[model samples]
Target: MLSFSRTRSPGRNTSPLAGGMDYLEPKRKSNVLGRLILIVSLTALCITMLKNAPSFTSPTSFSRSQEGVTHVLVTGGAGYIGSHAALRLLKDSYRVTIVDNLSRGNLGAVKVLQGLFPEAGRLQFIYADLGDAKAVILHIPKILLYEVDKIFSENAFDAVMHFAAVAYVGESTLDPLKYYHNITSNTLVVLEAVARHKVKKFIYSSTCATYGEPDKMPIVEVTPQVPINPYGKAKKMAEDMILDFSKNSDMAVMILRYFNVIGSDPEGRLGEAPKPELREHGRISGACFDAARGVIPGLQVKGTDYKTGDGTCVRDYIDVTDLVDAHVKALEKAKPRNVGIYNVGTGKGRSVKEFVEACKKATGVDIQVDFLPRRPGDYAEVYSDPAKILRDLNWSARFTNLQESLEVAWKWQKSHPHGYASS
Candidate 1:
């Protein structure tokens, strides 16, 4: 269902809901949780990796060592989750290096980090575009392997957190091949570079969208993956590819499948913004492909009347802080295993209205919403069965419920409406 070229849009533009992918609808449905979750998924697809590659953390990005501190490199560290994790690692006393393309992420996020951690003694930032695969692969591996002048040698990094990806659902749908190229293939470039560098501990930001709509509620890590959209499918492909690499490579991989990752850094430091409104990822796609997938007018509803509390959709919402904390904890893990999968979410569920209410409470704004129709290829209600993660990671959501996280997000939004760009 595509039909256009990939030429860049002139400026800011908002389209119809096209289901929950494009915009939010005002009306409520019978399946409260179901509809609610779909709504949250929109942002989730942006924040973490519901549409993106789930944000990851490098334990030793800056870690205490008998000698001094472990060097840590963060790809996409300028972005929301990456910046937050990067800042936390630096604060915890790890020497951190951030490499960002500055497409989806704001350079401002890195500025906040500079002011936050102060002292460039332990932190380094690089503006590297991964889009040029050959140049990137050749350049990064050399840095990781030999330590060069432009690439800061002498610092042996203990690990690398891969958070770089071109993430955008609607855009992905419009041009599936492009999303696959970056989110899936660009990651391959990172993996290859890391493999060549021999970085031991590598944490990945995978996503729950890999599972798509599940037959059972509280979907577990073992849920059958039948991604409905190009974005979800791309994530699934990335997970599979990473797993394969782990099968052969000696990389220590922890694959975290994030649910709805909401809220800010809690310390009022980092938050999510995309290339679209708050900003969505300025997605990369071939121009011919863009013209191929013509945008459908009005809206495209996948499914409205489901058997849930709300007719819309329901999703598991987790605090961004909780997610980053998990990353910092997983770093101490020292073992060679196939990519381990973990669901990051409060096993609890929340409706769209519930999330909105919390946002309203936090921001003290009743943001306008217009209801459209149901979206195809979407789940009725999907929450995480994070039991396995709790048992293994020994980490649970301490951020309370959806309302609590939303309040924190709202608070951050109120203080910095346009995100840290204002600051």
Candidate 2:
């Protein structure tokens, strides 16, 4: 037999057990209802606050004025090209938010950028991967979706300079999936986020490899894209996707196809310091620096049998600063619903022997080299027309002279012997 409670509340007409149950049930219900109401009210309050808050990219009075200033989001801003771009943006007085996961980029580079601009609002860093949609959304504050006029008036981002990609030709050849996933898929995610935020302008760091083993010299923007390797294929895929996205949207895009990027910040504030694992010295200048500095035993010339002037591969090496200057010009000229494709290179080519001589002259030390047979996927010669970019953006590579560019790079390499390492 179950025992019933004899104690009861002071009720006029109710059984003792029933009265006891009635006393406790209302209190439990009230507690739950109160909690539910509190939760809903808090959520509403947060949403309201977020809706009314000032723009994340807005400037304080002491900071750079918000007038005519563009806030730029630079993905992969800790890597070599990305870092240089970020530095340029900061120097040009654009409010910049750098989003990098530091997976392939260097945290030390981010620190260098932060050190350059100790100001609070001019520069910001967000450590997040482009692939993680949720984390990226959480870390990079979205520009409130609004009309173009309102976006400019509200001082939100006017553009996105996307440089986040896994960009090694040899490595991509070995691990194609990783390149496709990081370069193509991650780029799609970035495009989606940019679209969601209503940022109209996009500057893509494309590569000239899209025109792999071209039929002729001086490849143009209209050159047929028949990429030879996975790296080039991934970049070409991204370019196609970006173009496809533009067909239906109001996004203005500038796709800068680079031949080769070399040199560093002329001011010596930034340079190429690839992650320790990459162990990448400068492409040719960097190799010379490493050899001269004795970082490696010596440099090796991969192939000398190509049908070039010196029987070595010839590439158009563009100074990184000049490349970024084009980006700045592109940002200014990018009109909504317009797409611009330009080859960001000097209309010239440098052979391996020529680059070696330039490096030697720049460093004042002869770099020992060993000639080897042609490596697979090696192109005989590749250069850019650059006439289209010159006409459109009024942009041209200023550091076309190989020796002058090498000299600037040599200075940077000599100073940063360990490549961001204290040694």
Candidate 3:
């Protein structure tokens, strides 16, 4: 009996059966406390995760009131083509937000647009550089801060029209890294913002230079993209990224491979206003206008030894009006999860010599032409078929007459001798 049972002490269970139960009680209580602590920790973790989670719902889908009204974000909207495109979008009753760094673009163009569409929500202009990965806080008597991500986050954009880039071929050849950073890297930044915000429609302003010197004439959409210059190569790289991204997304994308862009807003409110330094590597139209205005002594035709008609480089020139029209059609016809690639030209090629003659007639000036040898990265000839765009979007170039297009542009040049600076 003495070995089997121990004497009971105060506040202790000495019996063998009772002792076992008593020993397990503290452990059971400890297990219950541990479970409560674990449950509390788990609940706190769940709450934090829920608080920090990103919303998958599209910003555009937040309101049924905005069903039919489409708000578009136009990058580089202060430049020539971009400004014209913004004007067209505004005229079509679509809300437009124009973002530009004013690097190659002009603040005067933005002012002209603001004057035209002074109605508050019809148009908004944001000064920003897409290449900068961080927030750009610009102070111009007024503190303005913005970034690509912030732009998409604040605005419920239905479509994005990306037209920002350093587009000079010669410049691109000299500074390949600048072209890559501006064209390719900046495009990736904008695309990332577009994807994060779940934007549905995208219109990329591409270049026919992406085709390099194709083996065939009148480049179709399916032509092999064998870009030669840094400009073309960078653009092609951006196109590949867009194509790959579209493959896995439901975004509607339209890549318009522009051959040559000329002319301006026919209303004389907007025009091509390249900086004085860019005249050498700027558009042929700008050079022609400069020579006509006596800003330059003569038009220096860079390439005149190519194996083409007139021994000059040939290109297809499309009017800004028709080009903007094509963009609108692409925007309207865009379908989810579909990509449309179109050669946006008049389906005809014009030699540089022929362009000079047309410019002479348009400006009423005997433009002295100095036919120089072929320049670096010069293509023999490049034009577009444009049949695919017509068949798909029911759009074709109406401003086919090069002389008439030049005349319209000349009128604006004559009036704005100093471009927007005249205003």
Best candidate according to lDDT: 3
Candidate 3 structure, TM-score to reference: 0.82
Once model 1 is optimally superposed onto the true structure by TM-score, how far is the C-alpha of residue 3 displaced, in angstroms? 91
Clashes (backbone N, CA, C under 3 Å), per candidate, total 60, 1, 0
lDDT of each: 0.68, 0.81, 0.88
- Residue-level lDDT of model 3, residues 50-95, one tens digit each, is 7666543333332222757898989999999999999999899888
lDDT of 2 at 123: 82
Q: Positional deviation of 168 in candidate 1, in angstroms?
A: 2.9
Candidate 3: which stretches are off by over 4 Å?
Answer: 1-65, 133-146
What is candidate 3's local distance difference test score? 0.88
Instruction: Give the alpha carbon lDDT tens digit for every residue of 1-423 in model 1.
Output: 979754434442345433324333333334677878889988777676533432233333333333666677788999878988898898788788888888778898898888877774578788876655454567764443232222323335678777877665566777788788778876776677677667777888878888878888888988899988888898888888888889887778888888776767777777665544422223111111111222212112234476777665677877778888888777756366646678888888776555555554554544444455654345678788888878887889899666667656555555664556668
Q: Candidates ranked by TM-score, best first?
A: 3, 2, 1
After superposition on all CA atoms, how large is the RMSD of candidate 3?
Answer: 9.5
The sequence of per-residue lDDT tens digits that candidate 2 reaches over residues 1-423 is 998765544543355555434543566779999999999999999988886686543455322336777889888999889999999999999888787888878777888988989887778777666665454466643322222223234435778899999887777777888889889987887787677767879999999988999888889888899998888999999999999999988988999899888888888877887665665422566667778988777888889888888899999999998999999999999988999999998999989888888888888987789998876556789999999999998999888888888788778878887776642
